[model samples]
Target: MAEWLYEAGIGENRAALVSRGTIWKARIELEGTGARVGAILNARLADRSTGKVTLDGGGEALCDPLPPGVTQGGPLRVRIVREAIPEPGRPKLPKAVPSDALPMPGLTLLERITASDVPVRVCRAHEPDLLEQAGWSEVLDEAVTGEIAFPGGALRLSPTPAMTLFDVDGGGPLEPLAVAAAHAVARAIERHGITGSIGVDFPTLANRAARAAVAEAIDAALPQPFERTTVNGFGFLQIVRRRTRPSLPELLRADPIGAETRAELRRIERLPPPPPATHMTTQRIARRLAQQPGWTTELARRSGGTTQFVSAKE
Candidate 1:
């Protein structure tokens, strides 16, 4: 077995731990008070020949040996040491810019959109003056409620000011669905004011004319503020939108998952405290049983017991 030693903190506030070879180290700078504090240390041993031995700050204690089937190794040891160090100066915050001024130019923007089993929208535009002025309130509001419906299903926006990528999925064959999806993509590009490299993956189309039509629809939907947009040979539509401020998504602080959606998700995953089963899970199981009504009764009879059905907890 390998031995490892670790130390942290300084003076009376120090702590140490020793164990098998695996160990972690961290450096922390302290300030002001040098009050008396307690220190802790631990050690352990492990291997095929010897099961495991553990030691704490107080002293070492023998542990029950492993079972015959288990493999053993050599003893493991850990140690920690602490020492006092001088404190450092606090970090300074950047000065705020005036609201009226326009954001600096030559900033890059990126966004990702997803619409498969769930819909998500993300945007990552460089920080800008206009966005700072609005305090990010307006941008957040627009991104969440903005629902774009395709013929197959509708997509709701989920924006972020970090790198964004859009993933497209086929929602089954429906003419209106394809057109609506294309339009939604066009609007998202304009609304986010995304710049730099942009890539979009659309549903695969077997017919060349249908592909051309989708590209044409995207071109027509774009607003005049977007100076130019071209469809490349590989079926990617590129565009440059006029920028006056940071894109709306940049200013907002929101997550991809909302409260209601999170709650629904928990139900779907059947996650909750133990003992109480979730109603959602119970209902799903019940539905399955209903589909094959004889399963429950047959299981109970084979097990030599009466079947007990309990309602699921919410």
Candidate 2:
């Protein structure tokens, strides 16, 4: 039976749906980010001309369809349609629309998984790690490396501001590789929770029937609630899905040092007592770990040993 395994980690909440001894889908919610999607907030209209609103806290949002007769700098009720997306230099502001509905808090990771109607098994620190048993770390590696392997080929995922792209590569006939890539792309899409626009570049096929076959494979593999273009002569296909929150790659790549630190914390916490006093790593990773004392404290509590830090030079 398929079940959702949730772990309230130190800095983030992680969940994975597992069935048949494999992970079908996964999600990670980093705590203390910005207002999540589906949150209703009272914001001040920062600019009527641009329809920008300042959230109660320290974030800004773009509000569409400005409320009628709402003066500039006036209070407005808005619902978050999309969470702020993190990028390299300039991150996108949260998107919202005017709403008169009652205020409501956003759903947490646990709530979202429970809403899926699947049996949820919450994992504790000292319990047998079900998520790791289900290849959770391997999935994280795929997200970090952006390489997903299928039967006959592999897909390289690259997430960009405008769209996420996938390039198929392997040693095989173009037809079978393309077909296999189509299904692999579908599975990866769900596994990573990739949203917004996505592009897949398969081996170019001059044969129209072969392209149709690839498109058919995509249709049969991917789930609904998304729109995709047919495979063209260049073997490029575009897919668009409703994006509310950041995907796995977006979360990890946005702050690589932080991701590495979190992974290290996970490893240290799982070690059978008497973990190393100091973890040696790059300066950036060590600095990031120092910034979050609470996380280190939690790790100490879980591992039965407090952790110190040392840079590679030391």
Q: What is the alpha-carbon lDDT of model 1 when measured against the actual structure? A: 0.35
Global lDDT scores for all candidate models:
0.35, 0.89
List TM-scores for all candidates, in order: 0.31, 0.95
**Residue lDDT tens for model 2, 115-194:** 98899999876778889999998998899899899998899999999999999998869999999999999999999999
Worst 10 residues of 1 by lDDT: 9-18
Which runs of model 2 end up more than 4 angstroms from their true locations? Answer: 274-276
Q: Which residue ranges in model 1 land beyond 4 Å of their true spot?
A: 1-151, 154-164, 174-176, 190-197, 225-235, 254-314
